[model samples]
Target: MIADDLSSKIRGGELSPGVALPPQKELSARYGVTLATLRQALQQLEDDGLLSQQPGRGTFVAEPRAAYRLDSLRGFAEDLRAQGHLVTTQILGQTVAQPPAWAAAHFGDADPAVRLERLRLLAGHPAVHQVSWIHGLELAETDLSGVSLYAALAEHGIAVHRAGEALRPGVLDQASATLLRQPLGTPAFHSERVTYGLDDRVLVADRATILGSMMEIRTEREVSGLSMQWVQLG
Candidate 1:
């Protein structure tokens, strides 16, 4: 009962994100419950992602988590922005170079490709680190700083027809951890995608590391619309 009431307050916006709740003893008194009971209720809320508890600091409401839609064709930044979230992109690097050995397998070894590295932030917190290798396009860093990669590709007459992606659980490495402001070995989601253009030619190969604490993968199912498969990783 206590958990349900507190959850309702949170969902109704009575408890806003980042707002600290009253001290435990005070809350217990207000709710006519013992301190132990109050703590239990708070724990329930925390487990549900409605609150955040810092060891030395008081508990506060958790920031809303962004959803990464499994069925969407839009880029991460574009999808979140459409849901009224503030998303910013930082270009880590961009260069014309030989695709890495892994990417080279997809894009033949004959031509130089544009390699772009980007970091996406949600409400000023780092959320995703992505690197993309694009073949046949001469792109500059400035061309993608504030726009969606798909939108940028469209500007160059490239339209994404479809993409195949694979996802797996991962832990943040030193480089990714530093960029995401998380400790090394933090849990993360790793995704690789190969996108084809309307002409049926592969256009971009992308790899991304998403902070699991800040985002959730979501998809809706219909009678015949979308399906999912689970694979075991060794």
Candidate 2:
């Protein structure tokens, strides 16, 4: 009962994010419960991601985790921005060059491709590091700084019809850890995607590493319309 009540208050914004809760003793008295019972309720809230407990500092409401939609075709920054998240993109590098072996395999050719590297921050924190190889689109490094890559592609008359993606659990490497400001071996999600245009031609091959602690993958499904499939990889 106490957990439910506090959960409601937190969700309703009565307990705003970063706001500290009252002292445990005081809260116990107000709730007419023992300190042990009160702590249990607070533990429940913390487990539900509604609160955070610091060792030296008191408990505070936790900032919400970003929900990454697994079912969306939108670009990462674009999807989060639409949810009212403060997203910023830093172009690490952009160059017209021969595609890397892995990216070349997806494009099925050795044709020159534009390689764009980007680091995305959410609420001023590093969230995603991405590199993309484009086959048909010509883009300046500045073209993607303030807009979605998909939007830029659309402006060039390319529309994404569908994409095939694979995801696997990984730990951050030295370079990725430095970019994300996390220690080496920090948990992350690694994704590879090949997107096709409306004409059924491969347009872009992308690789992205996402911070596991800051983002949550979410999807909704009904009995008739499932959004997920599992593939057994050797």
Candidate 3:
């Protein structure tokens, strides 16, 4: 297909987010040209973050970029401290076990000996609980205790390519209610995540249910092609 034509379609939102584009072979056949022609088109789209290619999953239209400014949200500790709230983490749990079911699978064929887990706090309140899993298998020695998981991963030169979050509301489960100090069955927000490594490998899966009473979240995406899907119950 003509690069100009393809670019116009994307710009017009005709080929919207999460929509898959025709395969290179198909585009080639339709455009009556070589695969190289199609690759050039896909390259341009990818550079713009409007299209994504997954070898096994094929290519698909990307979602809109979010507008949540990373700078506006105070870092966990600083934000709470600013409010005069003491932030402390009791280390409710820590382990380097197999990635939990919630974590995105790293390498489809990785051996079972790789994962990272932690329970974190904000203002002495349980705010983030996480598990990181990756295929490097070499990642077992990475210390994640009180260190930000992202920081630890970066120390080893592993940059996260992109990540997605799925949030939903639910009555707190027994364990969650107890931890977050809500009455049994109180409402909560479960933020589930699937983080990816620079190579597009799933690197972490996290399930954190926060007290809904204290937080409201909003994100805007029109440039980065990342997405956050959330449901509100309270």
TM-score of each: 0.79, 0.82, 0.53
Number of the top TM-score candidate: 2
lDDT for residue 77 in candidate 1, whole number 0-100: 89
Ranking by TM-score: 2, 1, 3
Per-residue lDDT of model 2, residues 1-234, tens digit only: 788888989888798889999899998998999999999999989977789999889999998778888778898888898777889999999888999899998888989889999999998999899999998536654478898888888887779898888888889999999999999999999999899998888889999999998888777788875467788877
TM-score of 1: 0.79
Instruction: Quote the RMSD, in angstroms, for model 3.
Output: 18.2
Alpha carbon lDDT of residue 220, candidate 2?
78
Supply candidate 1's per-residue lDDT for 75. Answer: 84
Off by over 4 Å in 1: 1-18, 23-49, 52-59
Candidate 2 lDDT trough over 10 residues, lowest sum? 136-145
| Candidate 1 lDDT, 1-234, residue by residue in tens | 888998998888898899998888899999999999999999999988888989889989998888888887888888999876889999989998888887877765647888999999998999999999998754654478987888888887778898878989889999999999999999999999998888778888989999999998889999898778888888
**What are the per-residue Cα lDDT tens digits for candidate 3 across 171-230?**
777877666666788766676666678778766556666566544455456666535444
Worst 10 residues of 1 by lDDT: 135-144
